[model samples]
Target: MKIITLTFFSALAISVCSLIGPTSRAATGIGDECNKGGDVKFAIREYDNKLVSVCRADGVGDCLYTKAFGKTFVDNRLHLNSDRLHDYVIKDLSGSYGDNDVTHFMLFAQCRDGNFVKVGDDFFTNLRPDAMDRTTGWLKLRVTRDCYNDSISDTQERSYTIVFDPKKRRYGPPDSNPKLTHYCSDAELALPVGSANSSR
Candidate 1:
């Protein structure tokens, strides 16, 4: 009887180990890490007499912050939306198109809470000068597509405007000055695209 009991207990332990082994050994993918808020870090600083902040990885990795407005934190820079305030804007290179020798551009904005959030999509071609209209609180950006193409480089230019809504403490939908002529590649776009709506 005792041998039978011991055998039963050993079988239970083996079954439990079998159940836990695969789960423990399974690799953690990006989606899994992102859902858990991963390993991003955020820091706040003072820029233009306003509190500014950035959320990035400890090492070079994907950014996880999003959202804007109010006293909420999201990506890089944070600020409140008010006419008396200047929105923090960041222009940076996303990455290169592998060996294609093409670089991409990305735009980021600061929310009232001192976190920076990305604006619009990646621009593939030549980007005209970016400007912020202080009077109307509108940000204007223009970009040309396929400027590097060898055959007559059919460069199509498009402009976009982003407006801030102080009441809602957020920016309105992005509007294009000239509608897109060609479809931009969705591949290799930035991560954490939209607002996470997180207070953190």
Candidate 2:
């Protein structure tokens, strides 16, 4: 019985050692760790100071996202009549949304010039770009619909004016012209970024 116990212990040690390999034994079987699973969502809201279009971009809030816990069930989401991507690029384009508890994100972009490319990893966070010009990079942006171990929140509604620098070939907020002090300010839930009656 003593010999048998010794052999059993040795076999257990060998089994653990075998799992340390690179590819084949990364982790498998009942004792292995599982990857966190969840979905990611992003919503974009844009508007002037009137607070008409400052609705929930995500089911909870505006055009925003995160790499962690997502929005709650108590969200006052935006009610949309269509899922169609309208005016893929708009000036004063800023919004917010929740992360839904996930890690790892990639943003894909499609320009009006038909140039499609991915924005790589984790480039957006508490991000409120001042403006968007179709001629520039903000024509279209995409987010990971699925995620792993992440969290996020939303952006408010305000006037976000974007302009394109033809020579610089870039987009940015102006120093003072139509200064977007409250680009996404005073945003409430369950409102749409269009007409007041349109917001739910």
Candidate 3:
């Protein structure tokens, strides 16, 4: 009876220990590898390991190494960080649009529960790089689109000012007066069903 009881208690303890082990979900996201390998320093780890700027032992030279996502390149020139709105980071990412044009846009991210999550939707799809401007608390971007509505089959450009609202936790259109123009979104530009251009 004593031997059987001991075996039952040992099995219960092993089951509980397995439940206490770290979960796979916790090992995902940006900066997840910061804590691994060699000596390291964290420039920004206030949000846990979810969003961090860390230099590992593999860093070039002596502690001069600073990196974010491994292998994922981020343009330092266009990167922006804000503490007034919850230590969020905005990265300007550039990529090819269609086949010919290259487009630029911004991504807003924040740390939540040891994971980095996107904070907002992009306001400009095809941003004009040369026309982008940033002030103390505002971001202005010029967007271009090849608009084709009825007889209008030409490219148009518009300016927009984006502001962050603390309550909303995302960048959005401004409230005050500004020189800006709103255009039809891609959904609106789609040809109607069975229209003359629908097949094409």
Candidate 4:
């Protein structure tokens, strides 16, 4: 078993779900917490704050992945709907299907009272900067059916620029975004392609 750790300082901006009277919110830089795991492990930790995320391996193969006992954490901040506070994006290992393993990306937002809360459902899979962008405070997620494992199949991808509405207290166009693109490739998916048993 091995462990990896990352430490850095960054300021995040995000806001809450409920519409309450505004309070003084600080644009503070949060910290990360992480733990150890399998053949390979990854964690992001901060020296000051209490926030943390960890990913442990559950199964052994060409790639290390978490299943029932496995967990992965991320601490990327996004300015979803507001400028005072920042939203957070996290990644997790959901589960597996046959020879394939699945991961999920979740979004968390802070409220007017200075508390963080989950904004929506598990809305993304294999989420990354290559497939999504949050630089403008609006999210442009290039959606695709994930093929993270060795399994490859016919798939289509789309790109959507989702905006958060403060008046409505929600991200707009809850349904699938407009703009269908092309099929998915192995390199685009960022995982090894072909059968699992095939020699690397």
Winner of 1 and 4 under TM-score = 4
Please rank every candidate by TM-score, starting with the best.
Answer: 4, 1, 3, 2
- Tens digits of per-residue lDDT for model 4 on 2-54? 22222211111222322232421212211110111111223223222323443
Ranked by TM-score, the better of candidates 2 and 4 is 4
**lDDT per residue (tens digit) for residues 1-200 in model 2:** 99999999999998877775443332121112111121122333323331212122235644333212232111112111011112222112122323322222222222223222222233122223333233332322221122112223433232222333324323333222222222221221222332212221
lDDT of 3 at 54: 30
Cα lDDT, all candidates: 0.36, 0.27, 0.35, 0.36
Which residue runs does candidate 3 get wrong by more than 4 Å? 1-77, 84-106, 110-115, 123-146, 174-200
lDDT of 3 by residue, 61-117 (tens): 542212333222232222222222232333233333342222333333333333333
User: Candidate 1 versus the native: TM-score?
Assistant: 0.34
> Cα deviation in Å at residue 193, candidate 3?
28
Off by over 4 Å in 1: 1-94, 98-102, 124-136, 153-200
TM-score of 2: 0.18
Please report how far candidate 3 places residue 63 from its true position, in Å. 33
Which regions of candidate 4 deviate over 4 angstroms? 1-70, 97-102, 126-140, 147-158, 161-168, 172-200
TM-score of each: 0.34, 0.18, 0.32, 0.39
Q: Pick the candidate with the highest TM-score.
A: 4
lDDT tens per residue, model 1, 114-161: 333433334444444346545434444433343222333433232233
